[model samples]
Target: MASASTDVDFNKIVKQDQTLCAICHFSWVQKDARCLPCKDKVHIFCSDCLRQLAHNDESHAEGILFCPVCKMAHRWTEEGVASFPRLDLFNSNNDDDDDGNRLRMRSRTFVDAPPNHTRSYVEEIIVSVLRNLHNQEIQMIQKINETAANHMKKVREQRHKLLEEVLMFYDEKESELIDIIREFAAFEKFSKKVGETNKKVTKMKIRLNNKANSCFHRNIEFIKDSSLADFSIGLNKKEEEFKVSKELCRLPTGGRVCNTSFFNDTLYLLTEKFGGSLFFYKLLRYQMKTGIIESLHEWNNSIKIEYKLAVSVNIYLLTVGEIRVQRVTETEDDDGKFSCTFSTFYDIMRRKNDTTSFVHIIGYEKGIVLCCQDLDNIFTFKKIKDPVKQKWKISLNLPLLKIVDMRINSSQLFALFTENLHYIFDLNSGKILNKLKTSTGSPREVLGITKYRFCTKILFQSGCCLIGNDFVRLIDKTEDGVSSWSYKKIFDLYHTIEYGKCSEGIIAFLILDKWINTVYLKYIKC
Candidate 1:
């Protein structure tokens, strides 16, 4: 029976066999669905089981379903089976009948057999569902990647803007800080300058105080006898009595007295009636016995007839009209005789123009006459040279204005004027060394022998007197405007005069009356 079964037509059996599973080698009756290409039959159980196997291992299942017996995948669908061409095995006239039948059987059998290994139906279904879910998950991941990329881009943009804003804020703050630093630097510089100025002022105040004390001590001897004869007299004449008179004297021209100055031990009186006539009187010796009144040689032809005289150690200077200067000297043999040694005539004349018309004789030095003409011109004249002839030899023409009076101290020249103008010039270089101006009023007169170490008493037309040492100390003014004697004060002897032997000293001037006098007291060194 086994031989007969083996001899049975295997080709026919295989071709007719529709009872195997395509995915797994299972009986056709066990699977519901059949693989058409393979012509394998399987039961309902096999179909579900094959599907389950295919789902569980989809990569391997795709290959298995295409082929069963030969392990080759089906090239065509079941619908093409009827028209599908088969390979030729033998020729009709050839004597190879056995070989042909064996080839046909092998080929037919290969086309109908199913592959091995079936999976559970439930498991296959679960695998298919999982595959679908995996595909959906991949799509969701792609979307999430895109959204993340967009968010990152937005964050970068916002960060860039924020960084820019922060930089701008810092720039503005830096600029403000720089300005504040500059302001602070400027304030520091200003404060330093103020401190330096304060120090200078303090030093000046201390020096001035010392000078004031010295001047107070010298005044005691200066006030007693300021006349040249009295100055020449020794201090032993402390008990000597001198006469004081207010008696009026008449001039040769019958003019009443207007002003007077004692020069070379002689009294020189000026009369208003004579325009500028000068009367000279000699000081005679009483011999402690006989008293005598003596006459001095006088010149009635003196220029302009009415003028003011300024006396120094051995010379008398007179100013007549605008820019006119004359010098009077005592004759060597006449004891009290006087003569005019030199005179200057000005070419330009402008009234009330103080800058061009005024001539002030400040002092004398080493036979050289020191004087200031007008506001800017300072002249020095040799003893033998006429002022007009030496005009081209003027020492300096300092640029200044409103000068009222001037004085010389050593190598420095001190000038005082209105607008609080004060100038100190160097004698050697003729350059201005220092300058000071007052804010209150113009200086009426500069009275002292030293510079930066003496008292300056300024008389204002408004009747105010300003007193100080190298600086303004006090101002005393009268209410009335008409009084020429509007200002009055007492100056220490040391500050007012050069001689240091003076006792108690006070200088009182009546500007309206044109009277000047000195009072003497005891000396105190402190």
Candidate 2:
């Protein structure tokens, strides 16, 4: 009576215990081939099924086959999964209250899934071996919570410091304005007689001219902390180097470097391809910190480089020299570091206007596309999408006059000049917000605006009458106040300025010394 029967129902037990493929109907007899990437011992279906899934996907052109089950789930090669922990069939070390998926099996108990009544079960040994991973996940989640708490604490502290900075900034500017107002008031009190008032004004003017003469124009190198001062010209060549990615960008042998632009810490080098387009042949990204040069994009021959090119966040590169194409669209997902992973392209459909001039494509910058027909008085303001039409792209218009020398500031503002009148356009809507006449004479539109200086709240406007001259203008406004960007400071560079770009705390300029026939690269940190 104590001895158990030796002959049992072997076929019945085999049918009950054998693992079956989720895809293939075959009962897998081998204990191996569990998907290693998955925490639970997910049975790997036959390779034929996996192969079929990969080829059937029409969009998998990049050859990066994704897991069929879920986008978040990943699968490991079955052949290489041999080193993973083996199945433990009879482990008693399992929680009884566990009710999670078997892939992350916390118990050896078999549970039936609904619908087809399929049983999902795996040995407890799998969980025991993968217990370290579960523990690590718990630790990571705790660390993330702690980091978020710390970030919130720091943000509160930063808010106070930022308020102080803004207050101090207004204090200095307001004080200067008050002094100027008092000076004008004193002019009225000087004398009622015309001769006496003219004599006093001449003396005041002479004194002001003398004060300006005393501060002689000085150009010197700044070794450190040159944020709002003269640009500290140099590169950290010891730590960083520059190289180009030849795979994506093609640069022919002995190709002459034509132009350069720097924005968002990435330097764009425009080079002319031999036996190809004489204008912009290729666009390359020079990541100075890493000293790597990769192709930004190989533009079609249609984009001819112009004296001025515009860069903005709305479009990758609108300065597609004179956008000849009636349809304009762009995105910057391919831009390194500054690119948003989500691609945003807009449709810039242009209606033929016989009264307008040629389509002047400033140049491509970020993702924003801005187009305006000169004589139409209808400025096209396009964005990524329009829910109104349930389409991926949208084309809209903004009412604006003939505006030129359009340049982007650090924020969503475009500075444009029409004669002596300066206008700030709302970036997204492209509406001309305000206009102020410049006292610094007409800003040299040929040179355009120098963008923002690194991290500082300063903008440089090219003001020299001659080409290849560097002029600095620090423009600022608080809140919604209407203020003119007066002539503040004119910092000049000796070398002829070829091209300049500024973004993300770095300002770069490509300069050429005609006398020496030498080209130089200058960059300043904010």
Candidate 3:
């Protein structure tokens, strides 16, 4: 009875054994099929379909071929790789029973090639690469030679014109000398002909003296006013000597100054008092020339003045609770007062708790931007025409983080984070375009940044100055878009520095000597 049951099960299994491809879901025979190296060992598809799938699944970067079923990578099996059409297999007048054995024997013979053959193949590839490199070098040398020839031609033309001018001036002077010699000879003849006291002799003597005098004046003028003296060649040299003028302003109470900015070319310092009830915070205005420190205005309110910004003809004084705009006028009165009038204050994000928060302000295009130091919140304010309501058009928040310093140009902003990371972001979209390391070697000891010329230090213009206790370097971008620092010992090292933009290539920075309790106004020629 058990033998009968086993026979029935074997019959059932053989009846259900029909081969179907996993990929196409069509019936396939065992002759034209391949399988992945998996535990199932079931026929998947034909070798052509498997090769196509492998080509599609190959990852160029990773340099690996993946299995379609398991989604895992593996080396090619011998039988599966030999089934490819391009590979030439051994042909013999044999039936299908001996085909697999013959193919295995042929593959083994191909793999056992001579060692010298592999070595020669690799050497040929290396020689081809070297030849290509030599051709490129030849082309580069030709380009350089052509460029140098053009520059040399221009230099030769300049030299020819200068030498010609020099030659012409000397030639005319030689003619003038000949005329003077003739005048002297004629004067001697006249003296001999007329004897000492003759009337004609006196007139001739006067004429000779006048002619000689005119010739001397003309020769001197030509030599002195020549264009040869006007030629100046500029060399890339460091300017070490600076014309410095310094003044000192002594503060009565050593209040912690928050920030500094320039408006209408005048210096303004924002100071905050810690505990005094007389004046909580004050804005001190100093004349750049006279070094006069006068309190422009004082506020005793609970909300603190964060920072001041001068953006596009408008002076914005931002505080924690409200934003104030002072219309910076072009005219100033004789009493040393700006013709600026304060507009009605606009509201900011109010303080949640008693915890202190610092707001950094930078003047951007057509508006002013304010950022909080603690939170990643940014706001843009544009002064509108209607003063009564919504005078400052505030934009949506910008997600900036841990901003330590910010420098603004017309288009972009360079935000320096607390971690010494520098980010360049566009103004309109608020998207970061690039990030770079500000310093490479030491712990960051950067004090602040001062805007110079048109752009800041990260840009490729007349670079700005970066002030720090360890070093004060003028950083500029190179042609390959890398920032390089030109170390400058232009100013004395101090604890804190606050600068205001003066004329082109000039800046007025205040150095606060913490030990002496004195502030020095330093005018720098950058």
TM-score list, all predictions: 0.30, 0.33, 0.40
Which stretches of candidate 3 lie above 4 Å from their native place? 1-241, 249-254, 274-279, 301-312, 321-342, 345-358, 372-401, 410-418, 428-431, 437-458, 469-471, 477-483, 486-492, 504-508, 513-526
TM-score of 1: 0.30
Worst 10 residues of 3 by lDDT: 1-10
Off by over 4 Å in 2: 1-261, 273-280, 296-315, 318-366, 375-404, 428-431, 438-469, 475-506, 513-526
Estimate, for each residue in 234-343, the C-alpha lDDT of model 2 and write its tens digit. Answer: 21222111111211222233445655544555555556654454444555555555655565455435545542223334224333324332221333554443322223
Candidate 1 C-alpha lDDT tens digits along 126-162 = 6567546645655666677678677777657755755
Ranking, TM-score, top scorer first = 3, 2, 1
Best TM-score goes to which candidate? 3
Q: How much does each candidate deviate from the true structure in C-alpha RMSD?
A: 39.1, 29.6, 30.2
Return whichever of 1 and 3 wins on TM-score: 3
Candidate 1 ranges beyond 4 A from true positions: 1-271, 274-308, 313-324, 331-358, 368-402, 409-413, 416-419, 427-429, 442-517, 521-526
lDDT of each: 0.36, 0.38, 0.46
Model 3: residue 68 alpha-carbon error in angstroms? 99
Deviation in angstroms for 103 in model 2?
89
lDDT tens digits, residue span 490-510, model 3: 333334445433444434353
